[model samples]
Target: RDRIKTSINISGVLFHFVDTAGIRETNDAIEKIGIERSKQEISNADIVLQILDVTSLNDEDHKKLDDLLHTIKKEDVPVIRVFNKSDLLDSSQHSISIVSRETVISTSAVTGAGLQELKNALIKLSGVTDNYSVYSARERHLNLLKAASLHLNQASDFIKSNNPQLELFAEELRESSDNLGEIIGKTTSDDLLGKIFSGFCIGK
Candidate 1:
């Protein structure tokens, strides 16, 4: 974390590291819980870092990668594919396509090789500005989106009917709007706030 003290400009932007963790695989129940927690963190993050051992992106690893990618996709998260240990690989044997549209950065983290390029890539991905404003949402927001979409379908069906119930359509629209308001915390309850903040660490 001390390495984060350096002052640097990236396309006229400043950057800093907030948190880091080392993932270890094990069959123990506690270890499994850690894995699940890591997965949750990735899902909730705006960007994900997927580190791959450059020298061993073989069949089994590829299959595991496929599964991991599927999970990330399902969570609608963007990933930066880091091909680590690049210095260990022979220059001529360095051709691999891990994920489509993913920004790939080959680096020897040991020697700080290609670190500058990696930092630039990350800054570009993080589209923050002096007047940056983010609209945050939760799982309830997604559920509301789904409900609104369903009501939209219902509205479409009503538009096709010979004699549509305008009252029904209006009620559906109101319910959808309420769901959305709850999602954005405009109409949310204290219970939801508790659930959300409880998931984070005490200091956060």
Candidate 2:
């Protein structure tokens, strides 16, 4: 987790630190390794917080956003899209637009603006909204869960009548089970394992 981590204790609630390297295009071999490590962290993260520098967004930033988001989307995890340095955003900044489906928050870390709202968004998306276990599950687990959920919902709609599409229902169950198996290394590929674990402890 490098020096980018710290405890944020607010109103008796303390959260563990999970930080990753900033993703960007780089030519240095050492930086490339760091980027791979960051990708690993992102794949295993609970919820991703993508912070965009409102004042510095350019064409290159827009291109990079698509690549970074592709990694997150593969896991089907919730994302908190934050626009940082809102204090520096001029009123004319509205002319520049970013298209995102996730919840967006304008934040000024220096002024503590939108800090509470950001935390609230985190708590809600992390499922602290419910009394569910907050175990840090992997990307495969989430992907499988989402697949299972989608199929299950579809199956329910088709099973309303006495004569249901048993074949389709069974197929969905199999798909969900197969996805779950991948999470436990049973059906996972060696390539996936290599990608997840081939990282050095840079600042541990």
* Leading candidate by lDDT: 2
How do the predictions measure up, each by TM-score? Answer: 0.48, 0.53
Report the C-alpha lDDT of model 1 over 43-97, residue by residue, as the tens digit.
5566666777888765564455446547666445556778889889777866666
Q: Highest TM-score among the candidates is held by which one?
A: 2
Error at 147, model 2, angstroms: 38
Estimate the overall C-alpha local distance difference test score of candidate 1: 0.61
Q: How close is candidate 1 to the true structure, as a TM-score?
A: 0.48
Q: Count backbone overlaps in model 1.
A: 0
Per-residue CA lDDT of model 2 for 1-204, tens digit only, reads: 232554554333345455666778788888788777777767776777778887776657545645676846744667777788988877777443667667778888898888899988777765553444343244555777788678668767655657666556555555655665554434433443344235422121
